[model samples]
Target: MKIDIAELIIVEGKDDVSALKRAVNADIIITNGLGLTKERLKEIETIAKDRGVIVFTDPDYPGSKIRNILKGRIPNCKHAYLNKSEAINPKTGKYGVEYAKPEAIVRALKNAKATVQDGSENYTLTDLVCWRLAGADSQKRREALCNHLRIGQANAKGLLNKLNAYQIPRAEIECFLAEYERGER
Candidate 1:
């Protein structure tokens, strides 16, 4: 399926550009991994202000770091999330958007979430613990929450920051936790 996206997608590398080309017809900017310079960021800012941006980084630490940086610089940027499982290259055991199937890419792009710039503190670390997103044996739950919320996986603190940064309401989180409990039970 071909998607016509008006905003330019910001990815980590050329491989990601290639993968996205197969899934949709849209303009893309390559950040060359964590090597994003101020000049490049300026260019990205220009494009983001003019046409908007969708950040589609890899599902790894570096990817999260890059996404955070972009979010800090460009508020209200859209985010496309692909699960780590979907991004794993079967042959190399590496993870990246380039390794994901075109269909998965299409799905992620279609469901991209826009950042909510509203300064609402809707959650705390205690909420993360209560939701099984922190403490021992929480990795699985954290991953599940990330997938459900489409926010990408992160450690407890990072998850809390993302939850607030995206302005996810406490009620929504409660619903997800309730559903997760039901599924686990």
Candidate 2:
């Protein structure tokens, strides 16, 4: 069934917003990871109260983390995880749903699942880091301090200066990232 959802996609950067707009007709909002402040949530909640709001994000670790964060702030905000295979190339593994082809984008929307809503669910800093690493490409250097860790390439470099190393090995970290990317765990 085709769900004509008039949802808004909250993303971490302009590129994400642009890519999503190109692929879908939904409204796009860029949070810039300021942690969904009270005012922002209020604005989002106001919109969601009447219409369905689907929080579409990158199919990486950070994307999921963003969903979790949004869940805490916005009521009636549904979440959708993009199918990495359909939205991205499994071989080259260039991450992000924007990389998805036309048909792939259609399939992604068709297969989108409802976001599980729960108030008490909480994610730790470690979880955020893991999400960032998982969202990264396999061949890319797993720099914990790299800006591109989570918010994505457009924003990663600037944030990199503010991040600290957690002693996460490139390979081990990639494995953790892979679990989410491949939807295995």
Candidate 3:
């Protein structure tokens, strides 16, 4: 199906933009994950405020971070985490949705939801960040967070917000893993 360009803002890399252009007619923007400039952010913010901004980032850490950054900046930006399952070479785990077929993109958007937030819980940011970086089972991650932080699900979410606000270092992800593992016993 052909998607119209008038209402959606497609956020992706240049190649993804190219693929998206080929797949459907959409207003697309490219961000190389170096973060957006204030001017660009403003333009995007303005467009997003008035229309729909669909964040179509690569399914990886940097891409995930870009989505997170945009969530904080864009007022009405909706995010679509491209399913790696849709890529032609799905097992390679590479970047860019350029390799994904048009059907995959469409399916992803159809199922896309509004931004997922940590909400107004009392948990620390560290807990949330750790949970994300752990690459463990969700039940395991939540259990670990609860066990280590001694906080309920409500507070665990707040911890995630706090961590995001503080800008946790990527290098320190290991520290969180260590702490979380230690707390398991």
Candidate 4:
């Protein structure tokens, strides 16, 4: 089934392009792994300016790094995130967009989030700790929160940066946490 998509998706490699093809019908540009050249960046910038760009990289460190680089160059680029667990193939023990199910890929694309580059700080480290999203023992909690928020997994500092970048309100976080607790109970 061919699903129509308007934006151009920026992926890591050919496998990602193939995986995305299984999910939706859209244009894609491969970054050819992490070694993004200036020419490629220029092309990406041109495409982004023309048809818009959605940065959908893998859930690993390299993926995040590439996404960050793209974001720096192309502000306001939309971001689609898949949880590491969702992207990991249990049989092969490999993690990538190619390993994610079609439904997961579609959902991530549909729920893509845009970065808020405004210089405004909403929450602090204290807030993260209070919400059980920081410190050594908060890994599980952080993962749950990230999944619920569709923010993907991150360490304390990274999560904080995401919170700030997304400009998520405190009340919204509290409501999600309360709902999560109710579901857990």
Candidate 5:
């Protein structure tokens, strides 16, 4: 028996469709990677108005880009965050929702969060820079932080927005950074 998801799940490709189908029952729409066109977004918006949407793309740059587009336009779509660690294909060494385990996919869907602008900027650009979450040599740190926060990987600006939009406190980021620096994370 599979889990029943009420929202329309959006993913990157057919492999993602196959993978998610193995995990749950839901209406799915494939964007074919970074190919989410205006027409497609319109279609998705129409469906989302009826059943809502869970944007569950791969845990990579392109995936993040796609999710961002949908978020900007749809405004209310739920987002699933599959850590890159769990989404990597062992043999191919590529990252995608298709590569993630069924359990991981289900877990991500179950924990999906809505990205909303609550007008709370808990952290700033300077904060990310001082915390080594931005600027040179910050990519890996950002990736690890996103994985820890289960908010998916993002570039500098996107990371800052997520840190604020998710309503994660400044103290939490500070503690996480300290733990990370101490190798106790």
Candidate 6:
């Protein structure tokens, strides 16, 4: 089933727009790049005020930079995350939303979460270590956890922040871990 998003979706470029079109039924705006004109920013800001915005960028450093710029300006904008693994183009070794399968894109957008300014911390570093999502021999574990959680890949700290920002419950984490332990993943 195609997901329908009311918010104006923001992406990096034309290809990302095309990919989103295949995955969802929504209006989209392309940022083009870091060089967003003041006028364009104003336009987007106005649109954001009228209709909420969802920042769905590539899962890469440059994409993160663009997302950060938008986040700084539009604190209330929701965020959709594609796992780095999902966004990678194996043949070209490129990483972007354009390379992700339409199904993956749909899944990511479906999992989009609103940022909570005054959120409670649901998990801590100790929890990450106890869950085997941090420290040596934990890279693969962390990746699996992030993919399963659909929050995108991150270091221990970022993962913790997302766990809280997305308001994911401690019980949910425990349940997922329990399933993972049982090889039900």
Among these predictions, the greatest lDDT belongs to 1
Supply the global lDDT for candidate 5: 0.83
| Models ranked on lDDT | 1, 5, 4, 6, 3, 2
- Candidate 2, clashing residue pairs? 134-177, 147-156, 147-160, 148-156
Assess the local accuracy of residue 21 in candidate 5 as a C-alpha lDDT between 0 and 100: 89
* TM-scores vs. true structure, each candidate: 0.60, 0.49, 0.54, 0.60, 0.60, 0.59
Of 1 and 2, which scores higher on TM-score?
1
Give the per-residue lDDT digits (tens) of candidate 6, residues 74-159.
99888899988999989989899998898888777667753222222457889899999888887877788889877789988888
Cα lDDT tens digits for candidate 2, 1-185: 12223455576677766666565555567776545577877667765664456776777887778788878777567666667775675777777756766555545555654322332223334554555633456224334324333423433433332232122244654565566467554
Per-candidate local distance difference test: 0.84, 0.55, 0.61, 0.83, 0.83, 0.79
Residues 145-173 of candidate 3: C-alpha lDDT, one tens digit per residue:
44554434534445464344323353554
Query: Candidate 2: where is the Cα deviation over 4 Å?
Result: 1-5, 33-35, 89-94, 113-185
Candidate 4 off by > 4 Å: 113-185
Which model is ahead, 4 or 6, in terms of lDDT?
4
Q: How far out, in Å, is residue 117 in model 2?
A: 25
Give candidate 5 regions above 4 Å deviation: 113-185
The TM-score that candidate 6 achieves is 0.59
Off by over 4 Å in 3: 88-93, 113-185
lDDT against true structure, model 4: 0.83
Q: Can you write out model 1's per-residue Cα lDDT over 1-185, one digit (the tens) per residue?
A: 46656667999999999999998767788999999999999988876765589999999999999999999999879999999999998889999999999999888987884332233356888878877789999998888888887777899999987776455667877887788888951
Q: What total of clashing residue pairs does each candidate reach?
A: 0, 4, 6, 0, 0, 0
Q: Under the 3 Å rule for N, CA and C atoms, how many clashes does model 3 have?
A: 6
